[model samples]
Target: MGPSTIPAAVDAAAERFGDTEAVVDGEVRLTYRDLRTRVRQVAAAFAAAGLKTGDRVAICAPNTWHWVVAALGASYAGGILVPLNTRFTAAEMQDVISRSDAAALVVATDFLGRNRLAELEELGGVPEFVLTIEDWAFTDEVDAAPVRADDISDILFTSGTTGRSKGAMSAHRQALAVAAAWADCGAVVTGDRYLVINPFFHSFGYKAGILVCLLTGATLVPQAVFDVARTIELVEQERITILPGPPTIYQTLLAQPGCDTLRLAVTGAAPVPVTLAERMQKRFGTVLTAYGLTEAVVATMCRPDDDAETVSHTSGRATADFEVKIADTGEILLRGPNVMIGYLDDAAATAEAIDADGWLHTGDVGVLDERGYLTITDRLKDMYVSGGFNVYPAEVEQALARLDGVTESAVIGIPDDRMGEVGKAFVVSTRLLSTEDVIEHCRVLLANFKVPRQVEFRAALPRNASGKVLKVVLRKESP
Candidate 1:
């Protein structure tokens, strides 16, 4: 038999590490025994409130102990967990809730100065019973329903970069597989302190963050927001061993003063600069770069023993249980137990994403070297032909990031009278920089066709909740 379901895994971990710390927030600390008891109580509360098997429960809140309890409670009650992005506007949240047909919602009354309950009330499609964390009651009479491995575990909504967001349905098996893969790849161990800065709505946070900790018996320290000074303080105070986020998080940490003592660092969701990887390795004990989509929680990750160059340039090999192949057209395809069941309520879209052979055709282009390291070139949709020369925006963006004083950069293809299409760059810099300066910098590294024809300066690039640059928004904003 394979590993147990998420709830079962938590139960086992709680039994093994009874009095050990399991979770830590600002003023709250929960031991494994306490966490298990609270999770069971929350499950009983959901059951007492009339939640049933296969029902969907939506949770829209920041990273907190409540978020963890509610999610596990829903799963324990045999309900499919639907984690809504706390950053989503009212309309976006409504669309997802309505589409998923969520029977109940558990939201934080106020977080980051926004009353999520009020936003839901304004939208007015909320289910009959809404519960806040403070009001969650514990009951000992209710028993959790038995869960099967094939049962749906979570429906994680995509970032909606291309169009309407699709909820990727993940089964209990897939969730557990992802957690095991992350633990093995990232070297998560019992008694390790993990600082979860990624939002709960993202797979990187929920599955790789929460579930990995549960499986490995690591203490989870949830951070609601990414404040450099606060994060540094937490790292020093808590002795955080596992910290993971996008490249920007590491870059900012590297720039911050007195920010060290991180044992394992994992970065993904964007291309990692070699310089950033080198710095992280020098500061932290190990640095691993991962790659995955919403459909698959973590498909590949660089091992801790990997050299800096391999960690920086490649996303490492596929996880031990997964099969990764580069299609003839350079599109990356993955087949494994971690692949999501399908997109919720969208069979046509699911068919389009996963083939009949069980291969998930990732729209990103990549190359697998002889050593099995996969280097993501760019998203297939982001590639444009400029005067018959193919140009990938990620390549241009990487070259732009190499320039001095450039903190962040994004590249997109725009219409051109002569070349049919040309690359345009949007940059965020610390020092004063001009369009000519950017063009001149690219001139040294990129080819004539690959060089951006126009440059736009912005204080920051618009990014989704997961830290991916929203090129769709950038393309619309660019003239």
Candidate 2:
């Protein structure tokens, strides 16, 4: 029988995989049975605190067993979960909580030496009753609330590069569908020790990272922060089988000495170079590439059986239960059960995102090859016309990635007196490189219009919590 809700899915998994280890965070470990019991206790506590069905519960914390339990428990108690990015400032978190109208907040008292709870309290406008992760205790048995597949399960806020963050509402079916699709595509299986380095606030980590593990009976090893040394130690000590993150994650792991070989490596959130994919595949037994947005998690993924070239260059075929089509304008459109319900309280934005025909107008540009693999070129907003030639920054960035000594690169369009707009490249390099050198390197690979007119070197590129380069920030910083 198909699972009706997220709670139901976890409950069924617990019954089937009773004694199997489900979650591991530092010294804490819990079996599937133990996880279910804790979830029920938390659910009971939430209900007793006067939270009702459909109430929103905001959780602002790092990746921890408490975050997992709070997410599951919020759903079990019939409340919708809103995971706030821990990297957000006090004002940003408060804005999300206020916008979400969260009835209660579960936040970490301290993380990375910053007292988030104290900040939230000082910021005011926070929900009255704030609960810390450590305060959670097992409570009396409570029945899981009855919920339909189409009921809203969570409202994930977008990264908000341009304006205020919009909450993407997702249904129970959508969440479960994406988790199952990721598991099927990534070959996630029982006993696989999945190291979740991606933050739980992001859909990739919460749905594909946490939910997938629960569905497939995989053991979850939660890494709150992405420290190279700690990650290497965990991979070796725990014998982690699955490691998924952005391209930079694999690059860092490869650079770290004594890093254990990975059984499976999944990379996304940014462009993956062919060289990086080939290297990861040679190092790790299997390397997979995937593409998805907050609206629909795991839309496309490269299969384990796919050749290195396919895994490296393309985002693979559309996932099962989803349909992908490139619009005439080259924008990637998706239609599937996994598409989010809508944007919370934003009718105009919701209408603009999903059309009457039921396709989510993904603001990304991509192409489908003869083999049906998809190559993401750039975001629609990031595309610029230079001297009547359309230049996709991602294409230029990919060429920059091939340059020796260049660790990472981000490209943006800046005003040009002659051309309408010209490309500007921000590079993080291992060695000092002159602008002339970068321009010369790009001229060899990219067209004249696509080549960066100016190059600036930085120690590191600005990135969000998910490791996606903040191109908007680069654009603002450009002269």
Candidate 3:
């Protein structure tokens, strides 16, 4: 049997693929052995700074070798990793740090011309042991911690329906299993160079992108930001084979000058047209579609041999040994080892999410054909995907509530050509308000993706019989 724990998996990768290239960042390339050595060095530094077993360590940085090293080092030190979105404001970052009760924080100071550490400190969210990614002085190596399969590995936060972010907890074994399952479905193997365009803060990036590279011995090329020109340049320069992201990524890449080096393309955060899938098949030899959330890292995937119709029309059959079913209300249900243990420190919410019989309610409506293939139809929640990031309407509405003169607001997602969808907010304000005024206020409190692009003035929001805002009505009339 292979290593189950992530730390052991890292060591095993070094032993098996010692001389193979492991990571390719700008001017810094490391073999599996060198990567393991650096990971242990950072792990020793974390230990010297007083990180105890099972303590929470939060990382707020962009996608780079620094992020991979820090995240793995925290795991080596037996810390439950809490990844924070780099796009979030200082106050928003504080909310997650306080909610997760992280004992330590590692932030990047040079990203986007902002000193994040000082900002967080100014906001009073700096934790016990704080370190900057640009400067790590410790060089001593320490032994990797003895982590069990059932031990909690990470607590990734996802926005909830009630304007709060909920942390979903997953064990070390589940994380590894889900990654391996995704690798198998996507046909990722040794010697393949994967350009990870997905942000490291999300599961699709951390669990699927990072762990898949660790397990399969594929070289990881981290893209800090998604740029069409730079991504193609990396594809040619690094000889990238596997690239996985949302549909928007492929649509942009397909329009660029041809680069036939791409071998596999995995996509799904938004709807993928059949024409796009066929075009992908011609460009990349293999294309696969997957369905997952923060709760389940990878629940379903299309196989390499599957046709374009199967790959495009449905999210494909369930992977990761998951049992897929549909509830009476049409919500997709999943029961498997990869399913998250529960939400962090919220038993009531956990029970509500996963039923007494153990099936997890996905809050996504889908249908299962006779072949057990799952096709996502619509979302039961009012959440929408913008540039592959989930934008919860309630969360945006809450931000609008703080704006002066805004009495009531309803947020909906409108389809866009570039981005799969963008937010459209309808405001009922006391005084006259301009679209720029409402958007400028949200820019300070929320992430760039969460800020509404379009705003409309309304005398009063449409309400239902229960006095709840009729978001469906607002969506239908979305601009």
Relative to the true structure, how large is the alpha-carbon lDDT of every model? 0.83, 0.84, 0.90
**What is the C-alpha lDDT profile of model 2 across 322-398, one tens digit per residue?**
89999999999999878888899989888988999999998889999988789988667676656434466777777
* Winner on lDDT (1 vs 3): 3
Q: Candidate 3's error at 441, in angstroms?
A: 0.6
Positional deviation of 197 in candidate 3, in angstroms?
0.6
- 143 Cα displacement, candidate 1 (Å): 3.5
Per-model TM-score on C-alpha atoms: 0.80, 0.80, 0.98
Tell me the spans in candidate 3 whose CA falls farther than 4 Å from its real position.
none
Question: Pick by lDDT: which candidate is best?
Answer: 3
Lowest lDDT 10-residue stretch of candidate 1: 157-166
Q: Supply the global lDDT for candidate 1.
A: 0.83
Clashing pairs in 3: none
**TM-score of candidate 2 versus the correct structure, residues matched by position:** 0.80
Candidates 1 and 3, the one with greater TM-score: 3
Q: Which candidate order results from sorting by lDDT in descending order? A: 3, 2, 1
